[model samples]
Target: MICVGKLLGVKRRLQDMTDALSDMEAGNGNRRILAVGNEPTADLSYKMNEIVTRYEEQLSGLRAADETNRRLMTSLSHDVRTPLTTLIGYLDAAHRGVVTGKEREEYLEIARHKAHDLKDYIDVLFDWFKLNSSEFALSIERAELAELTRNNLKDWIPIFEENHLDYEIEIPERPLFAKADPDGYARILNNLVQNVIAHSRATRIKIKMKQKEKEIEICVEDNGIGIEKADLPHIFERLYKCDKGRSDQGSGLGLSIVRQMVEKMDGRITVRSEPNRVTSFTICFPVKN
Candidate 1:
C-alpha cells in the first residue's frame, strides 16, 4: 500500500511539472491560466504588428499624394488663367479700337507669343503626366547620338542668337550611337538648353560631347549667375524654384524635365556649381553595345 501511494505521488508531481512548463511558455506563469494553450503557433502579436505598420505606411502615402495633386491643380489653374486673361485683353482692346494699325498688330503679336508659351506649357504638362503614369512608350531603335545632337543644336541656333549667347559645340566627327527614342532625346537636350538660357545669367554657353569609355558625356556649361550649393541637391526637384527670381523666372520646369528625360533613357545627370564662377550639367549615358 505504501509503494502504490509513492508511485501515485510521483506521477502526480510529473503531470504538475508539465503543466507549469506549458504555462510558462504561454507567458502566464505568474498567474497561471490555460486560456491560450501552448501547442506550436500560439502567438499572433508579431503578425499583427506587421499588418499595422503596412496600413500606416499606405495611409501616409495616400495622404501625401492627395496633397500633391491639390497643389498641382492650383498651379495649373493659375498658369492657365494668367495667359488666357492676356489673350482676352488683347482681343478686347482690338475690338474696342483701343489698339489700331501698328499698335493692333503689335498687340496681336504679343498675344500670339503668349499663346505659344501657353501651348508649350500645356504640352509639357501633358507629357509629364503621361510619363509619370507609365504611359510613355519608348520605341527604342538604333539612334545616332551625334546626328541627333547636331540636328537639335541647329534648331536652337535662332534661340542662341536671340539670347545673345555663343555656343562652343564639342562633338566627335564620328557619330556616337545609342538605343533611344528620338523624341525622348529631344526633350533631354531641349530642357538642358532652355535651363541654361533661362536660369544662367551667363553670356556664353558651351555644349560639349566626349566619349568616356563605354559611356558618353554631354555637358552644357554656362557662365551665368550659377546656382548656389544649397540649391544644387534640389535642383532637379519638380516645382522647386529659387528665391533669386530673375526677371526671367522662366517656366521653372526645365531642369526637372531634364532629369526625367535622362532617367527615362536609363542615364544620369550630374551638376557642379558656384555662385558665378561656372555651372555645368553633365549627362552621362551608356552607348549601344
Candidate 2:
C-alpha cells in the first residue's frame, strides 16, 4: 500500500508538469510547475522555471525594440513629410511663375532656404542612423585636442558673425593630448554649437578648454534663454525635444548623437542651464599620456 501511494504521487506530479508545460507552450508564460521539498520533479521544475524566465526577458527586450521602431517610423513620417511638402510647394510656385519680379526673387530665395533646411534635416537623420548602426566605428587615436578644436571653431566664426552673435574662444595654446576620434570629436562640438545657434536666444557664446590633473574639459557656454529645469535631465535621450516654443528647427537627435559618440570614445558630457540666464555644455576626456 505504501509503494502504491508513492507511485500515485509521482504520476500526479508528472501530470501537473505536463499540463503546465502545455500551458506555457500555448503562450501562458505565467504557468509554472510547483514542486516542493525533495519531490521527484523539483530539480526539473527549477530548471524549467529558469528557462522560462530567460525566455520572458528576451521577449520583453524584443517588444521594447519593436516599440522603438514604431516610434521612429512615426516620427520620420511626420518630421520629413511636413518640411518636404512645404519645400515642394515653394518650388512649385517658383516654377509655375506664380509670383514675378522682386516677389518672385523672394519666393525663389525662400525656396532655396527651404531646400537647404530639408538637406540639413536629412543629413542629421543619416548621421543618427549611421551612429546607431552596428558597423559604425570610430578611429580613436591620441591627438592634440586643442589644435583640433581651434581648427573646428575657425569654420564657425563666420557663421557666428553672420548671425550677428558675439563669440569668444579660449583654447590653450599648449597641446592637450587625449584618446579621441578627431572626426567624432568635431561632430560633438558642432552639434552643441549648432544647438545654441538654433535654440538659444542669446547674443553671446563662449567656448573654452581646460586641462585638469587627469582629465581635459571642453566647455561651450551661452548667455541664452536656457533650458527649463524640468527638461535638463532628458536632453540626451533619443528623439526628446524641449517645449516646441523653444525652437522647431532641430531634429532632436543632435544631443543624443553627441552623447553616444562621447561614450563610445570613453568620455563624458554634461550640461547645466538656468532658464533665461545661461546654458553650458561640457565634455570631459581622460588625459592621455
Candidate 3:
C-alpha cells in the first residue's frame, strides 16, 4: 500500500507539471508548478520555472522595443514632415512666380536653407540608426587629441562668426594622446557644438581641452538659456528633448548619438546647466600612453 501511495504521489506531481506547462503555453506566464516536499519533480519544476521567467523577461524586452519604435515613428512623422512641408511650400512659391525680384530671391534662399536643414535632419537620423545597429564599427587608434580638435573647430569659426556669437578655443599646442576613431571623435565635437548653436541662444561659447593625469578632458561651455534641472539627467537618452522653449529646433538624437559614440570609444560625457547663466558639456577619454 505504501509503495502504491508513492507511485500515486509521483503521478500527481507529473500531472501538476503538465497542467502548469499547458497554462504557461496558453499565455499565462504567472502559472508555476508547486514543488512540495522532497519529490523527484522538484528539480524539474525549478528549472521549468526559471525557463518561464526568462521567457517572460524576453517578452517584456520585445514590448519595450516595440514601444520605442512606435515613438520613433511618431517623432519622425512630426520632425521630418513639418519641415519638409514648409520646404515644399517655399519651393512651390518660388517656382510658380508667386513673387519676383528681391522677394523672389529671398524665397529661393529660404527654400535652399530649408533643404539644407532637411538634409541635416536626415543625416542625423541615419547616424542614430547606424549607431544602434549591429553593423556599427569604429576604428579606434592612438591620436593627438588637441591638434585634431583644433582642426575640427576651424570649420566652425565661420559659423560662430556668422551667427554673431563670440567664441574662444583653448586647445593646448602640445599633443594630448588618446585612443579614438578620428572621424567619430570629430563627429562628437561637431554634434556638441552644433547642439550649442542650434539650441543655446547664447552670445558666447568656449571650447577647452585639458589633460588631467590619466585622462584627457574636452569641455564645451556656453552662456545660454540653459537646460532645466529636471531635464538634465535624461538628455543623453534617445529621442529625449528639453522643453520647447529651449529646444525648438532639433531631431532630439544629437546628444544621444554623442553619448553612444563616446561610450563605444570607452569614454564618458557629462553636462551641467544653470538657466540663463551657463551650460557646459564635458567629455573625458582615457589617456593612451
Residue 69 shift from truth in candidate 3, angstroms: 1.8
> Which sequence of candidate numbers ranks them by TM-score, best first?
3, 2, 1
What's the CA error at residue 239 for candidate 3, in Å?
Answer: 1.3
Q: Which pairs clash in the backbone of model 3?
A: none
User: Which candidate, 1 or 2, has the higher TM-score?
Assistant: 2
How much lDDT does candidate 3 score? 0.91
TM-score of each: 0.78, 0.86, 0.91
1-289, model 1: which lDDT tens digit per residue?
A: 5587667855665565467556555654242222233422224333433554565577678888787677767778888888889898998898899989999999988888888778877876776687678566776667788879998999998889987998889889998877677888888888778777767777888999887777878998988888777878888876667765222344455677778778878888999987777888999888885
What is candidate 3's lDDT per residue for 160-193, written digit by digit as tens?
A: 9999999999988888999899999999999999
lDDT of each: 0.75, 0.88, 0.91
lDDT of 2 by residue, 1-289 (tens): 4598788998999999899889999999888889896787789889988998899889888998788678878888888898889878877887899977888888888888778777767877888999979989999999799999999999999999988999999999899999999999998999899888888978999999999998999999999888888888899987788983247557788899999999999999999998777899999998999
What 10-residue stretch in candidate 1 is worst by lDDT? 33-42
User: Which pairs of residues collide in model 1?
Assistant: 202-223, 202-224
lDDT of 2 at 257: 92
Q: Count the backbone clashes (under 3 Å) in each candidate.
A: 2, 0, 0
